[model samples]
Target chain A: MTTLTETRVDEMSFTSPKPKRRIPWGSIVSAILLSLGAVVMIAPFMWIIQAAFGETARAFVLPPRWLPANPSLENFESVFEQVPYGMFMFNSVKIAVIVTLGQLITCSTAAYAFARLEFRGKNVLFMLLISALMIPGQVTLVPLFIVMRQLGLYNTHAALILPALINPFGVFLLRQFFMTIPKDLEDAARVDGANVFTIYWRIILPLSGPILTTLAILTFVTMWNSYFLPLIMINDPELQVLTVGLTLLRGQYGAGALGPIAAALAMAIVPVLVVFLMLQKYIIKSIVSTGIKG
Target chain B: MSEQIMTVRSLKRREAMAAYAFILPTLLGFLVFVVGPMLASFALSLFDWNLLTPPEYVGLANWEKLFSDARVGGIYVNTLRLSLMVVFSNMTFGLLFAILLDSKLPVLIRNFFRISYFFPYVVSAVAVSLIWTFLFNRDLGPLNYYLGLLGVDSRINWLNSSQWSPLAIVIADVWKNVGFYILVFLGGMQAISRDFYEAAEVDGANTWQKFRNITLPLLSPTILFLLVISIIGALQIFEQPQILTSGGPGDATRTIVLYIYEQGFKFFDMGYAATLAISLFAIILVLTIIQFRLSRRWVFYQ
Candidate 1:
């Protein structure tokens, strides 16, 4: 009877489940499905890289190998020879840097004022900024082109840089980020006789590194990859950024010169990709923090 | 006390001045870049001007031409069709993928998918279009090769057919943007309270019911916001169609932005281009306002 009771206790007691041996069916299904989707998402990137380096032409009879049989630097060399590739890269870097720096100054200052300072017509001004944010860039395209031409900035990098520096989006984003900073920090700084600009410069800014870095990277990427503005503004091949140059090159070369163009495209994407990878934390963090208001 | 009051008043004056100074850079840019250009665009719409010739005032003639033009209807239809396809599909797929990613997956696998999807958003549209061209090319495109292997007709022209061209462009555009919408929805999903789900589970609610009641209701604001953003952005889409089809074999993918661009640059009809721009701007504004008004019925606020 005691042995029977012991056996009943053994049957009743729970055994620790073997997590490793038991297949994680939920995770397995998700992985397989998402992996399929990931191929769809990432295949184009691999296509460009292969096109840049590989000579595997498309064929209906057989699928070309995924990896290159004979990868070489010839396509890149050809790209360099055809366009002012180096100059285009320089112009892109220059415009992106200038615009990023300009946005930082303008956005931060305007955001600080909007966030911390009390002024006449503050709400109205903020409302105006919001309205302007809704105005499509195309609506302003022709007039901005006219204005830039009038100011003799057409076909120049400044044409691309100046019109863009007034990003209401940046101001709006920074203002939201700035609003989250504790008012006490500024008040404390003020007690030490810090002025508004001084406090914004010394205290608010240092505390806003994540958002600011995020904005800077975004601005840089936007400017780097900008097509519409550059396409309209700069016609001179010498002043062309990567987007304008690549389009012009492709139009001229068509399908025959895929290799060089692919190389150029690959080169064009790398910097933004690198920055995105390195500082990805800030990208997600900034959006998560500010998306509610947005 | 009198001296202190005097100093306080002076300090208030100084503060206002500092505020204005702080805002000056943005204000100047706003006037010179944003407001001034908008005013100029409106003014330009009233006149006939080409870069070669001086501007001539035509009052509402350009406006009349735009509204009454036969091409505008077809163009609008194409644009609306393309945009709605992109907006709806991107939202559905983005939300779907984000939900999947939010499931019980390994952190590494989840992060990989997130980056892989968002990769396109950062790259240039022109570059993206070039890749699409190669993939869609009839002679050597992998799309055809893969389709043939799947026992389908292999010699399809993806970007040329009127029926398929716009859809092709839409696919590319949606692929380009879905990652961004995923980011937005994922953020919204993360912000929701898990307590509601727990309570529902305790009350014997099934997964579907819980999602329909709790997740759907809670995510409405983000949905509405994404809708507005997508509509506005899709309305302005130029580069994809421009790069892919140059507005098509025969205006199959001709959008309003392309129309504006063609009139302004290719035809050098700045006046009409400006008019078309104003019309588009009006359409966008009205649509956005309508969306905002419509949001009240469904969009939940905390």
Candidate 2:
């Protein structure tokens, strides 16, 4: 009789009203912590934005203003007057565009060959190329400088463009992506009498839009932001890119005036930030997948 | 049969030729830029040359100077110390944020934090460093002002003082870079099987226990990958310190790469710079090998 009564009680409990959902304190706390961290992550950019538009004198005041009390474009005008900011931007764009397009063509062709075509010593060649990734650019910095000078390419944009035209990492990434593509598409194209180049140019390139965009964005950003090579290779102010130009601006005005320095930095950073925000999902996914940038 | 075989051979030959043509550009670049320079760097290390004069054979003098150079030794030590601090802070915060994001938060909120954290990384280091210089200003900067509000009266000489300069570099570097680690770590954590967690729960394991056993053991491979890359990158750090402190208030933040640049460009000592580059390569090579060897003990492949 006692066992039967216990069974009835258990059944009643099963059919009883569901208990109220407990508050998720753990999740709430995690969210709060993450939000705080996010602020710290973006605080510097905020500081730069406000300082860029504020009066130079007000920029350094203690308990800094969160927003410019009276925003002005005077700092940007000073930046232009102080440096050839326009030339710097143009040079940066030209080099970055050329490198990005050049890499797309070169990397895709090589990746196609490695992924689809059979050639002698292919494995050995691929391995040799991949090994270049391990050698730091510093190792070649001295010798490459000499080579550039000897070739009379020093102090020219070509010095930056030529070496960056072919990245081993890009080849590796595209090759991996190419291999995942179904072989049937290429086989079909071949059956229709398409040549190797035709197949790669038409079918493979079309299928590779996403990865190509990823690579283009990466190459563009890298080339745009590249400082070390340009700093060493090009000394002429006329040929200077934004990164090296900003340093010069800093040297002149960084101490007493935060406004002009901040303005130049804002100009350099805004384009990249806009691109990043627009395509963040792809950027994040690509970084996670490639895991090679470092 | 003979005709058919001939056609087959001709077709194979054509394919091979096409393949060679396809790879020719990259192959040429690889030879001239990568292979040629690597050999030339070592050869250049054996000679002395400034841009103004003809090269002279110095045998192993540059290498000998490397061992005796007091500044080089301290710079290496500084590089290693800064690298350790940056790597530790980056990895810790990276894993912490990844775990936090892994919680059952709304997707919209998670995305917000993700984008905010990663914003700094995509910007130019030069630009990022410039922004940091303002914030790290000793007297009127916001950091010190905020600290003052918290009851600290003394201003921290973030960029000017030797004691705080390295820490400033680490902070700026981690702020820009920790997001990369977070994304990588989050990817690694998501790649882990949910079945492991479910099984642990059935076994009556607590949250800490589950993380300690299932999450960590499974996350070991990712940990090792990030570790090796972070160390390598940290060792080669240049832009932040170069822009922030210019290697400092007396070489307090001088890194190997910066030193190499100064020697090669500023001082026009190409041979010594080449020697330093070679030493850095060897150090990185050995350290990477050691890490991999040591990883065998703790890295769980699954």
By TM-score, who's the top model here? 2
Q: Which stretches of candidate 2 lie over 4 Å from their true place?
A: A1-23
lDDT, candidates in the order shown? 0.83, 0.90
DockQ for model 2 equals 0.72
lDDT at residue B75 of model 2 (Cα atoms): 97
Q: Against the correct fold, how does model 1 do in TM-score? A: 0.93
The DockQ leader among the candidates is: 2
Per-residue lDDT tens digits for candidate 2, residues A56-93, read 66777767877998899889999899888999999999
Cα displacement (angstroms), candidate 1, residue B109, comes to 1.2
Per-model TM values vs. the true structure: 0.93, 0.96
Which whole-number lDDT from 0 to 100 does residue B117 have in model 2? 87
Candidate 1 local accuracy as lDDT?
A: 0.83
